[model samples]
Target chain A: MKEKPVLRVTSKLLIPPIMLFALYVQFHGDFGPGGGFQAGVIFASAFILYALIFGVDVARRIVPAWVSRAGLSIGVLLYAGTGVAALFGGGNFLDYSVLAHDALHGQHLGINVIEFGVGTTVAAAMVTIFFTFASQSPHDPEDLRDEDDDADFDDDFDDDLDDLIASRTMSQGLSQAGGAGGREAR
Target chain B: MELAVVIGMLFFMAAIALAIIWVRNLFAVTMLMGIYSLTAAALYVALDAVDVAFTEAAVGAGISTVLMLATLSLTKAEEKPFRSIQHPVSLAVVLVTGGVLIYGTLDMPAYGDPDAPIHQHVAPRYVQDSGQEVGPPNIVTSILASYRGYDTMGEVTVIFTAAAGVLMLIGRGRSGPGRRRKTWDYEDLEGDER
Candidate 1:
């Protein structure tokens, strides 16, 4: 049996740090160069790497198709939901100041929520694409069968014609002998 | 020291951009483009446009690459051979654009000079009063979500629209279920005695 390539120890070790960096970017958007979108990609890339190494089937098993779909929808909804919340708070749509009586706190909460939504949607979409491509089976077996049948038909037809010709020649010889006997008696 | 670093970064960014344009393989070009976007984001950070950088890094490096790969998967990765001499025209246009941009930049403020008109503008008010008025530690967040809340809403809507477009373009739609039926039929046939 052929051995399958396993996920390397280095990749496994790298995942934790990448995940931590994603969190750092998510929470530390104010002070640092990173934020929700970059962080989200980095987060997704970790999983993508895993999928590349272990195969798409294993990755799909970890993050199922339906779940990724839900994640995509949920992320958009979560981002949109923040805006709706602002609308209900008696301000124009997405006015985070209205989210709390203290407008600054509202802004913080709103950005956080929307960032999370963006992250989720981006990650899920990436995984979903990988799944769809990787899951497709390569060969169509029916085409092979059709070709086999054509070959078999040609072989069978040739053999059957040969058998029929042999039988006909034998019967004709027997009939000729009988006729010869009858003529001799006369 | 910072100016030297910025110039070095710009050179790196230009190299990446050139590499992306020159790469023959679409997938390789996409990857290089992601690197180019990241480098651009880093430049944005040096310029203190953190929010824009963040968005660029995410959309450009992450979503754009995925979308490109998805598109590549649906089409042939290689460009079809063309007998046209369009390369010279493309190079001329690119060079002209680059010249104009460089000429425009020469008149702009030196990189990150504190007394630059940008630093003296209403941005100071936002940076200072955002904590007091909007109550967010991240002033950009405060401004984006509060003072310019309607714009953010519009942006989100745009994202939704793009996602919808992507779903329409790449989605399996009604054909997925039909494909499953074919697969199942094939399986059933395979199970029968040959």
Candidate 2:
């Protein structure tokens, strides 16, 4: 893929605009049709396109795994934290009107912050999933061997714990668990 | 004009579905599915559901198609030959389900009917007063981001969880302490071989 000059040039030309459009969708969502979810996916699509053309490894180096993992957590925290901020403002949970001196201003501010959070999480999640899938061997034999090794025992355990807690809260409860279970079986 | 576009896209989608059913090549089926999603996205735009259209275009036509292609690279390109296509029980089930669905649509309101039950519900308040309440001109955004913030947050979390699960299952450990090494990087092993 990296050897193709035409593809490299064309993708290089297209990627920037695709990314710009994604940002437009993310920020202008309040006045336009798109919001975080759409924006995030669009943003990920740009990276996916890059990966397709240049290579997944190259793209991963630019974004990296930990950066994606952090983005995932940060986005959720930003959204939930906004709600908590509302609570501290002497309003009910997720009530944005009390965030500022002016109700409309508070609503606007809260919506922007939350939408940003949503966009970040959605984009990171897509990238992480893509990287995970793309990185796997087509004929996987390491599944058994990898499970047995435990050198960074504390780090792996903590990472697994973080992912589990995040997933539990984020999941739609019963249905998501069932889907995750099915994936695990595979 | 919108009706004409909708009808054309519906026919196009049906043709794509029929082609998908007839195609034995799994690769072709995946491509046809992407086309189907693109058509559906266009149909959503014609129906004035731009938000939904945007999502379908990005997710259905873009990411999912790429994912399916990635999955295909890991599996056989040809679908397995079915032992038999005709089963009386399966046919009966399909016919019954389709009939039930069509019958259910018969009781629904016409497209964009102001008096529809859904329109009569809390939709009116959201449409009329959301400007004052949530302060966003886009009613959809206001409803999603403010009026129903919790649901959106939960949806985000669901996506987050799904990605985490995928990473846990198939993702190589990050290259650091306790890292599990790959037998070979796809680039190094498969690139030159191909």
Candidate 3:
């Protein structure tokens, strides 16, 4: 089977401008038609399109699954950390005004930090979802083999073989069949 | 100020809306929906709500359509062939709701009225003091991040929750590796013949 091409040269060409636009939105939210959340999603979507065109394995190599999970956790932590910092500063949760001794600049700094955090988490979560789905096995081999074997076997032996294959496949297919051994392998 | 532009925009919006309702193909409907969002964003710009227009453009034209397309991939393209008779009672309910909305709009201020209640209320505070209060050049950012910061936080939490839910529902569950192993075993059987 011909594998569908995921990232075309044209798509690669398209990503730069879109990413630049996302940056424009992120930094220029003070002036223009974009903000952190929107820019983050757009940025993530560009990668997502790349993954869709390319295989998930390639995408995973670019942004690995463990890294994506860490990205998500870090993004949330960065956001909540800012909030915690404010709390330590004797302000309410996420009170930007208290972030610095100079109240005015503190709010600006706080908003920027939080938005960045939100953007990161959103992007990472999106890629993670794509990876999770892409990683799922769409076919079962044992079932196929047993079906094939049944076709070759004689009627007398066929029923016995079928029952044995069915039970074995069932036990293997269910994840909890051998608890400790399976967990260790994983 | 031109009569032609206003008429054209209205006609375009109507045409797009009609297309959305009329298209039987889900893919076509999704494309039309993107067009509808873009046009609506344009309309928001024309109405001078640049901030709202920006958001509508990004969320509606960008993210929503991507999500819709992603969802479409997991399901069949066509609607099921079953048809239900249009009930008069349901039609009446829709008409009544629309009528009420129209009736409410009739009493409201005309488009872009400076003296409107909306302009006189919390908006003026946001416009005037946002730069001074929040120290951000953009009033929309200040409002979204500071004035209504709690709501923004809530929105983020909601998205996080949704992402978690999707991850849980679809991520590497217990059976996945076993399924892969079963496939590998079958492939081994095929290889044995060679």
Report, in order, each candidate's fnat: 0.28, 0.68, 0.35
Q: Tell me which of candidates 1 and 2 scores higher on lDDT.
A: 2
What digit string (tens of lDDT, one per residue) describes model 1 on residues B49-107? Answer: 87788778777876566546544433334454467676888999999999999999998
Interface RMSD of 3: 8.9
Superposed by TM-score, candidate 1 places the C-alpha of residue B164 at a distance from the truth, in angstroms, of 3.3
Which residue window of length 10 is worst by lDDT in model 1 chain A? A166-175
Indicate which candidate wins on DockQ: 2
Q: Give a tens-digit lDDT track for model 2, residues A124-149.
A: 99888876766554354234224322
Error of 2 at A52 (Å): 0.8
Give the poorly placed runs of model 1, Cα more than 4 Å off: A1-9, A30-33, A129-186, B25-31, B48-81, B84-117, B174-194
Task: Quote the positional error of residue B63 for candidate 2 in Å.
Answer: 0.8
Candidate 2 error regions (>4 Å)? A140-186, B174-181, B184-194
**iRMSD of all candidate structures:** 17.7, 10.2, 8.9
Candidate 1, A1-186: lDDT as tens digits:
012223345557888898888888877865555555566677777776555444444555688757777877887788889889988999777777678767767777887787787677766766666545433332332333344433443354435543222222222221222233311221
What would the TM-scores of all predictions be?
Answer: 0.66, 0.82, 0.74
Pairs that collide in candidate 2 are none
Per model, state how many residue pairs clash.
Answer: 3, 0, 3
lDDT of 3 at B23: 70
lDDT of 1 at A124: 70
Ranking by TM-score: 2, 3, 1
